[model samples]
Target: MLCVTDRMKLIHTKGTQGIRGHTILFVVIGLLITETSTQAANSTDEELLNLKLRLNTWKNRYRVLCNKYSELAANSSAPVINCTGCPDGWFQVGDQCFLLTRDVRVDWQASKKKCAEIGSHLAILTSKEQHEALENERMRTRVAYTDFWIGLTDVENEGDWKWVDNSMLKTPFWNTLKSEPDNNQSGGEEGEDCAVVDSKSQSWYDVPCSFLYHRVCQMDAIPLQ
Candidate 1:
């Protein structure tokens, strides 16, 4: 019933309306995506801020505790070295702190005395784990085939080894390869009375107490409250 030109105009109008509807739908979807991204970014910023605040709070608390400990230590006669953990330059293993000194080499007796002066004792390797820790530390120093004195000696009675702590040696972890503790008395030595740990093999060997070597020191870790 309509003329050709009118029919064409009606078709064009419908097409325009359809295109406008699609544009509106796309704009709505884009706005939703942008809003969601903004919200997520805001949430992430809040979480990061909270984490930073907590870290700062903990650091402040640690500083206060350190100051308190220092004051207490100054007043006490036998100053309790209650570290929050191991003191600086000391490594913590289990409940013990260990320090290996590579600079100063001294005889067994002198080494033991030095440790006492520092409120520690020559290292006592009571277990394989303790031995391993010392071994690992030695490796870290990159000192190859070096000997380090431990807190073991049979000076009181030959063949009756004991720890400096006065504990009788139970199960020995000696390196039998070179027939160690042979008491070889080589080079006119009296006897091999003191024990030294070999860096390479991580094994124990007895050398003359007068022999100079590096030393390892051990102390009890600070108790946690």
Candidate 2:
């Protein structure tokens, strides 16, 4: 039979092992809880990101629909061309109104006057975006392979170009390949001082202001109240 001291020792050892097992079990449970919390946080972050993307898409769609509605409303008023956004025949792009004419061909001066009569001016392309828009319009209308007048000229001073709005022409969009703005006279007393959109390249070229051609007009788009 075992002694009393031996029995006490055995009980103590078993008790220690039981305490160790419980400690290990508690550690594993804690680790599992931490892992679950981290996974839940990551899932929440992904969901939030998805929501933001969807919101942006919906906003863009709403803007397009609003513009379409505005266009339809403008068309409803037939006789009176009171365009609150863009006129019936005009295109609205980036807060501006553009009108491309194919039928009316006239000199640069006459074209400018006509645009003024319609409460607009010859188009002054200040950026590549405007230039691309004009190009697209030209293609859409399928204007003849001929020059079209724009609002740019070096009339005041030689080699010093300016727009009809008195804005100085900073970025030159002339066709370099053709060596444009050559100020060619083509057997005329007045050398080329006006700007024209070359039919071939859709780039600006200096031509005589007296030359007759179709013109593009632009004005600010009236915002809806």
Candidate 3:
């Protein structure tokens, strides 16, 4: 599989004008090698044909996915992606790709910017199922105790919470034990505006946006057609 950068380079290179023919030639060579190996293993011709057909079908699907990605990248600030599924570090969960930042701990605003730099937004979970899926992935991490900054915030209006997409919070999984979104302003000059999901408690809490914490970035994962 080609890396995102390599795919972008191939698409832009003038010398790659005959990429279609080159790609077809490579596929044919690969198929021939497979056919030879299958024959050596005493495989039937019909089985070989079926395998080739499956490969061809997948190849066509890959091309279509690549073309769609190119169009999206060209039209917007989306990251240049050639293949489908999640990126290298991202985990897939029900058509969405999520990345839990492990090494870096930054303020909520900085975390949001970092996610945007990679062509993804802060994690905006809409349903309990999605949230649970992400939480399960988070639990699998070595540093499962650390809290993660989500896309939720009450920046504009103090009590009116909204996700990164500007959608109002509907089905909140707030930690009632903590009495969260209490907008605690004991030590800080600003009120608690950003939301963070506590890994230990398994619930959300509103904290000062300036507080340093790990972040979760999310984006749509292209489905294999």
Candidate 4:
């Protein structure tokens, strides 16, 4: 069995193969180095404060990655470099794992929290492939819910959407026909700050964060040797 330190080292030495693979190295290195530097006695107050802020960012990344690692590992596949597939109950699309909830409806924030409770977060679709994969998955599953909460939201500043990872929204697939994400005031007092994918139309639309809906949770699929 590979130890945590050894696994970290192995990841560094081999490096992740793709764009997202390097994410672990970047976050882990920043987290470890910033943590060490923060302990230095000669650091200025401003420097310490900056380090703490960066550390917090890195820590968030670490938490997201760690959640994926734990979930994938929990599936009990024989330890190997190449991953066989996503764990039970999670379907794989590219290098990520996703879970579509059923018989459970909750508000956007509650859905996000529930995903975290299970070591995941609301789905963040960054690519057309991911979007199509999820659409097909929804069709195949035949769920009753048409709208499912995703990770995209403009809660921090309405109309300026971002994912759970704080990344700016790119390659969006909003339902243009509906003129969605208008932050429609009719939705609620705070307006529609959260996004949900319409399973039938295969498009996303902004909705009130307080509205109850099913959710699609996602996490990275990290394979360990």
Question: Which of candidates 1 and 3 reaches a greater lDDT?
Answer: 1
**TM-score against native, each model:** 0.61, 0.60, 0.60, 0.61
Whole-model lDDT per candidate? 0.84, 0.82, 0.83, 0.83
- In candidate 1, clashing pairs total 0
Better of 1 and 2 by lDDT: 1
Residue 195 displacement in candidate 1 (angstroms): 0.6
Top lDDT hit: 1
Encode model 4's per-residue lDDT on 1-225: one tens digit a residue. 999999998887776455466787799999998887886644677788999999779766766665676777778783523343466778888678999898579999899899999899999987777777777787788865678899999999877999999999988889999888789989769899999998677789998899999999999884532
Cα lDDT tens digits for candidate 2, 1-225: 989999999999999999999999999999999999999999999999999999778766766767677667777963333334677778777779988887667998999999999999998877777777777776776765557788898889989999999989888889998898898878287899899876456689888888888888899997544
Q: lDDT tens string, model 3, 99-162?
A: 8888668999999999999999999876667667666777776665558999999989899999
User: Which ranges in model 1 have alpha carbons more than 4 Å from their true place?
Assistant: 1-84, 141-145, 187-189
lDDT at position 165, candidate 1 = 94
Error of 3 at 32 (Å): 41
Q: Per the 3 Å backbone cut-off, how many clashing residue pairs does candidate 3 have?
A: 0
Per-residue CA lDDT of model 1 for 101-172, tens digit only, reads 867688999999999999999988878888788778767766564678899999899899999999998877
Ranking by lDDT: 1, 3, 4, 2
For model 3, what is the error of residue 144's alpha carbon versus the real structure, in angstroms, after optimal superposition? 4.0
Residue 174 CA displacement from its true place in model 1, Å: 0.7
